[model samples]
Target: MKTKRVMIASEEVEYDIIRSSRRTVALYIRPGGSLLIRAPWYVPAYVLLKFVESKAPWISRHRDKLKEIRPDQPSTMINAGDKIPFMGRELTVRAHENSRNGIYVIEDEIHVSVYGALTPEKITAFIDNWYLKEARNYFAERTQELVRLHGNILPVPSSVSIRKMKRRWGTCRSNGAILFNRELIKKDKELIDSVIIHELCHLVHHNHGKEFYALLESIIPDYRQRRRNLRNL
Candidate 1:
């Protein structure tokens, strides 16, 4: 991976370039306004730079939108009354001290009960662990349902796994395995399903070519809209 700078729309944009064995040139604007370009190893540097220059307007628009939606500095500490994003809704965090440690959600609040003094670290850990468990169960069941619903067009995944990923919502490996970012569990089901369907389509079409998107559109007619909604998040 190499970092490069380019002039896009008169703005000096810095981006990371990662060349892989993959066959396509893909651009990703990650959260917090970072730019990443994934290209085939055979593509020349000049070609990649020209490609970035060509997408100047798109880069500028999406980058500005991302910066606007994302906070300049997100707080790292979790405290009572703090709002947490869950299933596309902001749920208030409520802390309690009890004889036993436990956590649950009620309506729009996450009630966290700790056996001892409440600390920011403990609260963060409890919430993260809870999200992980929920992501595993939710993604597994939902993936199965989607596969069953679209069995004629979708392929059953070799396996489904979840983890915290910085830049990707979900990915489909060459071996037919699907891995989803645990953070996706924070989004609404519609966005989650969009990612699942996108990866499931990959099981049939391994690349992001015309046929792949054609299949995707056949299943989710508004996938483009879903992607736009997700980028806003």
Candidate 2:
């Protein structure tokens, strides 16, 4: 991959072209803010540049998504006898031959009883699935609680739904169908609650205006902290 300079709106928007075996051209921005253009090994530089130029609008639109990019935190495997943090404290996972396939949060650690030795990737996959299941349950209960608490002040009667969104943590639809990012499962429970609460506030005010923020502040006092912690996760 090599970077080539290009001018956009009087600012230098760099274009990186990565040579690959397949015949394709795709552009992306790394989490660290580096721009990339992936293309086939045989594709010419001029052709790739033209494609990028045509997709400039798309590039800019995706830049907003890049703003949400946070540095990766160190992660370890959720293996046997390994302790991992949930909301704040650590839980130790203990694998037992007689135990069933499940995860339990014990004092100071989470216990995962696996049947056999698994790779870190496989363990993470299991943990992620477990969290997603838990998130669905938690969100359903909490959304109902919020509706009961603030429905009187909200502008519309909305329903909450869960889905795996790539670019957004949560979105409030005009019809009031709130959607949450499935990635939230990777974080702790408190962070997940914060995201839920944030979306619930949107039920009252759709936009991030002064009234919306004011209401959110009243409902979730430490929303900013929650936002920060979520980004860190």
Best by lDDT: 1
Estimated TM-score for each candidate: 0.67, 0.54
Model 2 misplacement above 4 A: 1-76, 98-100, 116-122, 154-159, 165-167, 183-191
Going through the candidates in the order shown, the clash numbers are 0, 5
Q: lDDT for model 1, on a 0 to 1 scale?
A: 0.86
What's the distance in Å from true for residue 172, model 2? 1.9
Angstrom error of the Cα, residue 202, model 1: value is: 0.4
lDDT by residue (1-233, candidate 1, tens digit) is 13357888777777766554569999988666667787876788799889988888888888987755653332587899999998888999999987556788999999998756777756876787789888999999999999999999998999999977889999999999999999999998899999999999999999999999999999999999999999899
